[model samples]
Target: MDINMNEMIKDCLFFGMVISIFAYGFGKKLKDKWKLPIFNPLLIAILTVIAVLLALGIEYESYYASAKYLSYFLTPATVCLAIPLYQKLSLLKKNIKAILLGIFSGAMTSMGSVFLLSYLFQLSHEQYVTLLPKSITTAIAMGVSEEMGGIVTITVAVILVTGILGNMTAEITCKVFKITDPVAKGVAIGCASHSIGTTKAMEMGEVEGAMGSLAIVVAGLCTVVFISIFAQFM
Candidate 1:
């Protein structure tokens, strides 16, 4: 007899909750105390969790089965980003042109540069399509990736990596380039990375977070629009 899928999912969820707390605590310590370059809380937690489960002879497949229900929240969780955009409506109106230009340019630069390089590498159609949405937010990127027959998991992985890197380098890069405006910083995070970058922006302060939130919406819309055009011509 096979194990019940529902019960399996519960186990995963329970473990995930525990792991997340561990990750947070780990990240917090890194942020507050000794600043070690090797302190990637998520990475450390993920590896530790996986190793513990594996050593205990727990099957990964069973864990995923139980957590499958939790995965249902992914799309909706991403869609909720619109709330922040609505909050910043007034600010957006004040500098609409500059914000729009900055966001669109950043998004185009993100996707275009990836496409070109992937093309140079002779990537397959599916691989190229995957990169197209890498600059957009995770939720929209997953939806777009699915629509274009690209691998959603691959898109998600790429986007996460981009977010981590973006968050890490944003401050340094912005200062070096003299990007003194909050709007520009926000757009840069959303376009160059997406949700992960927002986390970094959040640490910067309220203004930065608001801008990043708004940037996510604009960047997602811009990618959809421009990619559609690209598809029609190519």
Candidate 2:
């Protein structure tokens, strides 16, 4: 197999863009079909990208080469979440205790669950740490995984799956529990699910959307602190 690093990088970017578009198209179809709870665009995009990459027998390194530049945006995109939080400052101040506790608990549970489950399976050390930040936002989770000497790529997959599960279940959980308050609703989804859950909350209405946006930043921050505490204790 002839492998050119430059060519591989270019291919990653090209395929990543193409798959992302396909996922967007699929999401529109899903929305039209009324599969509201399960049809998250990020989930669609991740699945589509994986399928295409596998089918084409392409190496991820090649694609990353071309796509690495785009990865830089992850940081700024995370920072942009501040806009939504700022828009709802009063709302945050009103429920600061619940928001902080709930997010911190959810974040801890997410990581702790992955850790316990993977350990029981006797996975390799690399696999264990790679899955550590599975519940947090992707950019931060991946960075943490790398710093912890884990596989960033695997951690990305964990984040995607965790986000999808959170997005898919938030509505059902809320409904079963008869949760009507937008603040509670948003916090539940955002803390448990992250961005995908936030997207689902957006479809709910302004109140829920605002709350969910707050969830994203709060949960992200809480997750960071939770991980730090865990590291210190360990």
Candidate 3:
């Protein structure tokens, strides 16, 4: 039975990878055809994968055992964002002050709002900390959550939802707020949504993509410091 079980797991290792790639590819096709924000490929891929797992009666752990390999690319992918920033190096230098200030304000607002809502709802320290890093990337958010004795899984979930919301509403929000500047738009999206929103920012324009990439790194650092100070108060 042990041998059989191991063999089964090994054989199914590629199953998760295949399913993920297929689902995302299908989602991309749908988005291309529909051209709608609601049809976000990542969102669709997530839902599709979940549904597939449920329908197939596959345990999430098993699926993740193989699917986690994709995550290995995350660090390199994030680093690659620097390319856009480098391309727009002159623009970054020209508006360094405004960019830094915007990211700082955004990071503060994210943590502050969570603090206020957690207090209003009477959430525990663990829960508050879990949510405090919701606006940052998964890598940094997970570390912060773990350091603060928060639930890492919950932090990841919150971050995903935050990113998806930002990805979906970025354009709408900008229009509603009359934010016409590409740099400001990039900063807002990256500060609020991290990489997922950065994807959308890239689609908007090169300048927006470059600024969004910079905001991700700066806002992440700011959140780390701000969260430490905020935790002392809690």
Candidate 4:
């Protein structure tokens, strides 16, 4: 009977959903209690699920087979960021120049820094391309990676780690540098880390959240264009 149950769980269609929900719920609980960006619910949920899968000796393919459905909504979720941007239209309008400058500079820095490091480290062409769009959202980054002949899985992993680090360190870094401007905070986080970092911006304040949201959109577009052109030369 126990063996049969284990087999049934393995083949269960809803098992992935169950795991995702459980992991997210547990993560949310920890975030509520700890109130630290390092305890970000998404990060916690991902780590928890990975640990569970490894402990259960389950293959990633088996889990992803059932979990891929959740990924279908990523595009829509990315689009939904416009809500906050719309709400902060006046502020956006007022600081259009600053916002654009910050976004453009940050986007370029992300690409340039990666290129320089990849070259300095003597990384292969594939590795360089895969890490190029690490600062963008996964949906756009994966597309860029595919076009650049990079490994999609490696791109995704790099994006996640970049976002987690950005979210975890943005505040402390800001304080150390005495960056108290709301727009600056938002733009810095959004451009450097994309959506994951925007979560921390949102927690900081409405202005920061709005700017961060706007930064994600602008930076994504900029990265797509720049990476495409850069890849042409590669």
Model 1: which residue pairs collide? Answer: 8-66, 9-66, 9-67
Error of 2 at 96 (Å): 2.0
Per-residue CA lDDT of candidate 3, range 1-234, in tens? 234443365457687788899999989999899977667777788789989877756677888888888877866876675675576667678888999899999999999988999999999888888889999988778778889999987888788888878988999999999999998999999999998888899999988887887888789889998798887656
Stretch of 10 with least lDDT, candidate 3: 1-10
lDDT of 1 by residue, 172-197 (tens): 98899998887778767766877777
Judged by TM-score relative to the true structure, which candidate is superior, 1 or 4?
4
lDDT of each: 0.74, 0.73, 0.84, 0.84
Q: Write the per-residue lDDT of candidate 4 for residues 133-234, one digit (tens) a residue.
A: 999888788878988899998898888888879998999989998989999999999889888888989989988887887888788889998997655434
Q: How far off is residue 198 in model 1, in Å? A: 2.3
lDDT (tens digit, per residue) of candidate 2 on 24-98: 798778867887655666667667766766676766666566556667788888778677678889987877887
Of 3 and 4, which scores higher on TM-score?
4
Angstrom error of the Cα, residue 43, model 3: value is 1.8
* Model 1 lDDT, full chain set: 0.74
Clashes of 1: 3
For model 2, the local distance difference test gives 0.73
Which is better, 1 or 2, measured by lDDT? 1
Best by TM-score: 4
TM-score of candidate 1 versus the correct structure, residues matched by position: 0.79
